[model samples]
Target: MNQSRVTDFILTGFPGLHQEYYGLVSFVLFLVYFVTVVANVTVFFLFATNRSLHKPMYYIILNVSACDLLFSTTTLPKIISRYWFQSGRISFNGCFVQMYFVHYLGSVNSFIFLLMALDRYCAICHPLRYTTIIKKCTIHILSVTAWIVGIGAPLALVIRAYPLPYCGSNVINHCFCDHIGITVLACTDRSPYSFTAFVGAMLTLLGPLAFIVFSYGSIFVEISKVADPKSCVKSLSTCSTQLIIISLYYVPRCFVYLASQVGITFSAGLRIVIIMLYSLVPPMINPLIYCLRAKDIRQCLIKQFYITTGRQKAQVFAVSN
Candidate 1:
């Protein structure tokens, strides 16, 4: 067993996928990455530039879009490089940096979702006091707090992994440098790191999850109190998109985590594919969901496009005249 401080890591992105299919896989991943970037960036721009979207609800969405963009950019480019250019080697410092961002951005996203749920709960459950409860200052404070906690939580994990001896294998089984993937390569007793990671991962996933569930539960109770069926329907509709988005983000992650815990065996490639689905699918679909399902965003986009087209036609007519 070669034991020295490992300087670089070779990523086995898709271990089970045959070499003959790497080209096709890489091409498909490129398409997904392209769409993920474009879609998330479009929504982020809409949120930033549109004055009408300057509310707490949309503010949280803007945060989510930013997180998704960072998340995808952090994880996907390396994977794409691995498959497309056969460039899978990442330096030691680079690996930790990537791991930090990967976990940090993910934690930030979870907190944002928790904030979104609280926003909806306030909007529906305490309509009279919603504005008072979620003022601009409050939103700013909460947003800042979320970012701090998200980035801070992962810093500890990185510090723990940094001092460990990595004289074992330099090859990381997964595409990205997660706590689990990187720590496993350490030659020392990784139990403490593993335990710390488990606790952190649970807090990251389950803590927000518990809050979201409580919020929606309370939301449902409030919705049930409405006398008019149409009013009830209208109130519930506001939350449907959030519900769908939460399900998309959390369910597959929970499934993957639980499956691994219970020793439900999955092939290396299958596990990587599952993780990719949870990671890539949310960013790809989140913007689409908002654009398709949220009337205001969709209308704004359509109206913006129409105005641009009309201006182009007017320019053409002016030139001809």
Candidate 2:
């Protein structure tokens, strides 16, 4: 028996979605893409313009914003086009490229989250040494290292899956090209590759999550011992916000991976929905949770708004004269 190689893969946005809802789905995805880009860009602008935000914590936030922006750009446009313009087909090389960034930036985010947890732990647990430990230089180095590590970690996945003989079924059931989604379409038995990807995914997801839990646990304990009520409340509020963002990113992802590994059954549509929620929601809301809520960023935004508004009024007065 002979088989022909698959040169392109068709992305099925949602397996069960009807044509009638394509417009609505595309509109929603367009909205998400728009928000994700704008929100992350705002973070970039803030970090670049405001020298006051050039600290270790804000550096980590900047890294996260970049990752979010890149990840959304990689995955969302193709899928949105799939639903909107009815162009869901991606070339083999293009699919692999998408798969690489989807996992690469995701790993970068996980590492950044770990850095954030470490930052907070030091600030709350070891305040005296926090400044010394997590300095601008230190974070810059760590963040650079994270990006480097992120690049190599997901390369293995692409390398392993890319050469596999994909002879049949070029349709990907999900919105984008991911390791599991692409590998399953291979003609060979995908069990080994799937298992390898699963192990890699778990390690990527769980390693940082465990540390985040420990860091926050310690922070909570420290907060309890603080005598000042105001300080305790402020500390709790900060940690709680971080935890919410963390949960949004990690929990659904872990569940999806675990379910697949354990032979649990779920609808393809449901799985895609869960994946979208975990992938897109955090980036959209991160600006609100991390940037806008911060006192410095809020004040800076207000100050900028007024300055821009005053400039516009002055221009109008000049034109009137």
For all predictions, the C-alpha RMSD in Å is: 1.5, 1.5
- Candidate 1 minimal-lDDT segment of 10 residues: 1-10
Q: Write the per-residue lDDT of candidate 2 for residues 136-223, one digit (tens) a residue.
A: 9999999999899878768999998899999989999989999989998888899998778877877778898999999999999999
lDDT of each: 0.89, 0.88
Q: Pick by lDDT: which candidate is best?
A: 1
Please, what are the lDDT tens digits per residue for candidate 1 over residues 118-152?
A: 99999998889998999878887999899998877
Off by over 4 Å in 2: 258-264
Off by over 4 Å in 1: 319-321
